[model samples]
Target: MSAFDVRDLLKAAGHPGQLKAADAVHYAPTTSAIPPAEVGAPRDHGGAVSPVVLAGSVRIADLVLVVILGFAIHHIQLADMVGLGWRYPAAILSVAVLAVALFQAFGSYRIAAFRSFLKPALRLTAAWSLTFLVVATVMVFAKVADHYSRIWLATFYGLGLAMLLLERFALLHFVTARMRRGQFDRRTAIVGGGPLAEELIRALEAESESGIRIVGVFDDRGDTRSSSVVAGYPKLGTVSDLVDYARSTRLDLVVFTLPIAAEDRLLQMLAKLWVLPIDIRLSAKATKLKLRPRAYSYLGSVPVLDVFDKPMADWDIVTKAIFDRVVGAAMLIVLAPVMLGLAIAVRVTSPGPILFRQKRHGFNNETIEVYKFRSMYADQSDFTASKQVTRGDPRVTPLGRFIRRTSLDELPQLFNVLKGELSLVGPRPHAVHAKTNTTLYDQVVDGYFARHKVKPGITGWAQVNGWRGETDTDEKIQRRVDHDLYYIENWSILFDVQIMLATPLSLVTTKNAY
Candidate 1:
């Protein structure tokens, strides 16, 4: 037996095993370990899921269409009756709202509903019929039933239901086609390979309609214990390797198949995995240990224990994108003169490009070109930013000093925000090669990459709280990372506004600003 075999034995006995590459092959009772093959290639599915045409957006569109249809029907029927007052239009609006609300109450807009045509169609029929009944009752109670045309109301109801059903059918077709093309599926990875992993894989594969495409399996155990193939899925790599893979790919979820009773093993895995900006769930079906009902969350009908959630997900991401564009555009327009004046000053005062584009770690550790007004002499500019700029740095120009102090240099990044490369408020993007105390920022902080789970921003909690400017020491970067993680965890639109509102005051004080 090898060192890895001994390690695995120790790990099974509840000791935290060292995660490393091992060549030994060991067998479990039901599933035997196979020799490791080459890591599986990433599956290619054409195009990402369309952000604009999601189920929620489609539901809202359905509501708007219903209101529009109602208005059209009312206009056609009541055209002959002059000065009928706002009663008819108001009734139409109320009925439309109530219809959409009923649809929501009946869960007509759920993903499962979109997966099949008949389910949503039936729900839509029921919801619309209920809405019409409620509206009729309200009209009767108000003694206004006689004021509206009965034939017109009946015709509108039939037309509205027909239109909604047609819409639902169209959406169903679209979603079905997208799923077949692998565009609408969630990319998932199993965190361990064993009997439990095989069982989970079987369960997931059995429900192909669930839209979870398991990318592959990842295990820290060597071939001795963990199989190279678990239920036909290739073991991708170790948990550390999984982190890098997830960071590079569009992995939506990481499912842990390790037993919940194995607290030490689970915690060790989570310590490495939580840095990722993906949903982490412990597969409850793999273990017999059951928790309270509230402790469990479901993915379809499968119960799993929620661990860490990807920050700024789904609607929150959409909301933040819209907020960034609107506010970023407004800020650009409002600060146009200041930016214009600064641009001219930089051009005349120094011989360099007006805007400096430097590579920074973006949303997923991807290198993105972050824009800034040139604040250093062109000849002396450090594109890599390996050397930290200090107070009264000789490389800075006269104009650069003033602009850097006042943070006018960062004004050009509003365009980056407009371009969707940055957020209005998030963890500030660090230069790709930025370092502190002769070491990379990631080296100083344990879960440093976790901050990059969300998009980098122009001004963040760290910047507003005086974590900006030169990060010369390990403590400074650590503090900044701590604040960034805090912002990510507690992010809300109001919190962003609060940070943005306080930014100017923070800039004015300029404690660490060079």
Candidate 2:
């Protein structure tokens, strides 16, 4: 039968679609019991799942629910006691604030707490009860306990606990349903398909509750030494193939099973793998060497040595996003007049659109349209930027020359920041086909794609530190990459603010503005 006919017959027969030869070779379709590699015994990696998907939303919901419950109960029971004055509502707000603080302190909002319902439910209950006790004690100490009705206070405590418990139960149900569909689990892959990999897979499977779903294994060797299937999992491809696969997939973690003693092999693997934006860990269970307690992190009791971490992960990403939007919006407001004047100048000076939209590499090597005021004549503009703009270029208009020199042409990128395509501060996005000295960027630098681990920004450490503007030479691009890598390795809100403050000064210098 033809392939299409066979596929249709299989679908009609209620079987899954046939796997292609490539898919069959890479994926293990059958689930068979496999022996774990010889290693340490499994221990409790207790707590909620690591990398909760909706942590920020959950926290916000928790706070909102608490406030609603506090006000609802207060209105029902204590409205008449305070005579509709601001004092009672102010007191309720104080209680809500205390509840949120105690919830955070008790680790109620942690990833581990959200993995299971009972733990977080208990935690929420404790936090709420403690908040009530603390607030009641303060009220009594202040000699205002009589001002508040005892019935109202008692009702508030009981109702608050009930409401929090209900919220936790609902959240637990929602997360459980998502987990069953393999939604929240981290998409992980095992590096080095051998005995160590088999052991790691077995351990991860044993603690399936930990939210690590290993897709397959990857090994450089293809001979009988590196079998097509290790344990029950198939060897997807070589490490190089893993890089391409990672680019196409939403891969979260890569657990390397190579021994720590094999420094050369480990380094070789890392050099190729580091280009992708994923967490890379060394399997500690495979080695006999021991390190301090703090040196190890657990993947469900399977200890792994940290090598390279995906920069600005989880809450850091959330905080940076908030900072970008708040700051980006404020800057757009402050620079609107200047941007408007520039837009009018560009439109009148050049017979083209006021804004120049060019495709650039965004976070995780994805393509995004970046905005800037058109700085060159319509007919002469290099959309791909394959040819670098040089000093005294005839294509640059009178207005374009002025704006480009003063960095005013980049003001429209504040909207890109607000649109969430770029950040206020990060490694600047390069044109989709950007080249340095007639060579592609990745060909020039070893781990060039690593700079894309974070969102592209309007201003960056490289820009602020004199690495901005024309990347005419290979050394210039290399130095820019080095500065970007440095920024990624050591990033904080304070560091971003510092770079932002230094940006205007850098712009005024105009060292390489062409």
Candidate 3:
């Protein structure tokens, strides 16, 4: 079926971030587990320039420059500003905000605008001039113009505009260098080969500023059904091979060119590909099915249906990283004395190191060392955690039990948060070999690896909702995974704050923590 039908099927998947089987097809979730050996050593793709991040950063920089220039010009023009109470700072802040709003309304923050020097200079000048005119008119009508000097206002206008243009010129060179190195382009890949794939690739290439770089093509069929090369791009591998390729490399968009009539093939490919944390699109250029204009999103001029979107998009990732480092650092400073006392307690009571390090799966299933206050005895500690800790386990020291139940042992992971290996709120990272009964966590639940789509956290929605502690049964682990997936789908800055606030309350019931 084409996207017209598959779109409806995907709608039934409940959450937009999840994938489910269509009513007509029974998905068994029987695809071979991702070989454990390939979990680490992710291949580097050099550097990737996300347009959203670049655009947002540029916008923020413009605002800062405008505000600074306003203040600098005022101070230079009117050194005796003792009479002005809050008017100067408030006026400059308002002008700065309105100036940025005007720039955004005029489309001055686009990636293409930054690629050239002249276009941005002209646009910024126009927006800045208009911002001054509006503010001056407002001040006059409010009868507040008598409080400000005309000479100061004029100086700010000229100097601020000049400063903004100079910033744009510098940015132009930076963007140009990045473009020459191909860092500004999205690393895209095609999922099918033949006439449809050729048409899609050519259409994308036709747009000179599409910012899409076709890496290669991937198909499961033999050479007889699919060509070895299409539109000057070689076939990289089969569908399974594409999964491994994406996991290792920095792959952005994955466009499927298989015909809409091939429902079974599409279903199977979606089953395998949905687990990946990448954007998946179905090419609608060659499909006979037609949907409303809003139903299809375009890549360049080529229409496609967005099947999946990567969670924690560009700006969200930036915000989360900033929040983690800033808050994590502050927490460390505030709790230093408590942590020191706990360290001393552990060292004195146990015949082991104060800190225990274990390998845990981090973002994208990469192995990272997670730190904790040593809880088990020196010789009895299980670094791999092949054996689960149970209630009243002899390995736990007296001090260790108190720290574990109070969750003071997890304070050391705040360093991991600062190191960018963990978030303050996300799926809790599990030991690489953590399991329930005889089955690995991944085996116990389908799409379990999806939790690693974001960096694991010190605490999460599952923990705050009473899903923390030991998982001895499949049901317990399954519920934890379900809560984790829900958190991933509905994550926001406010949601994270809520989870963090509820964490201490959750620690009261540590019945399951050994």
Which RMSD values do the candidates have, in order? 6.5, 11.8, 5.5
Whose TM-score is greatest here?
Answer: 1
Which 10-residue window of candidate 2 scores lowest in summed lDDT?
38-47
lDDT (10s digit) by residue, model 1, range 1-514? 2222223444575643433211111112222222232223232211456333486797689778988887788678767774447987788788878987888899886777888887668888999999999999988999989888898889899998888888888888888887776677778999988888998888888775567888888898988998888898888778767766665456778999998777777766765666667788889986797688777887666788877787766778788989999999999999999999989999999897999889998887778899999999999999999798898899999898888898889999999999888999999999987899688777666667778878899999999999999999989998998899889888999999999999999999867889
Candidate 2 yields a Cα-based lDDT of 0.76
Q: List model 3 lDDT by residue over 329-419, tens digit each.
A: 9999999999999998988886879999999988766789999999999999999878788889998888888888889999999999998
Model 3 spans > 4 angstroms off: 1-47, 85-98, 130-148, 180-182
Clashes of 2: 1
lDDT of each: 0.79, 0.76, 0.81
Instruction: Note the residue pairs that clash in candidate 3.
Output: none
How does candidate 2 fare on TM-score? 0.81
Off by over 4 Å in 2: 1-76, 79-148, 173-183
**Error in Å for residue 151 of model 2:** 0.8
The lowest-lDDT stretch of 10 consecutive residues in candidate 3 is 21-30
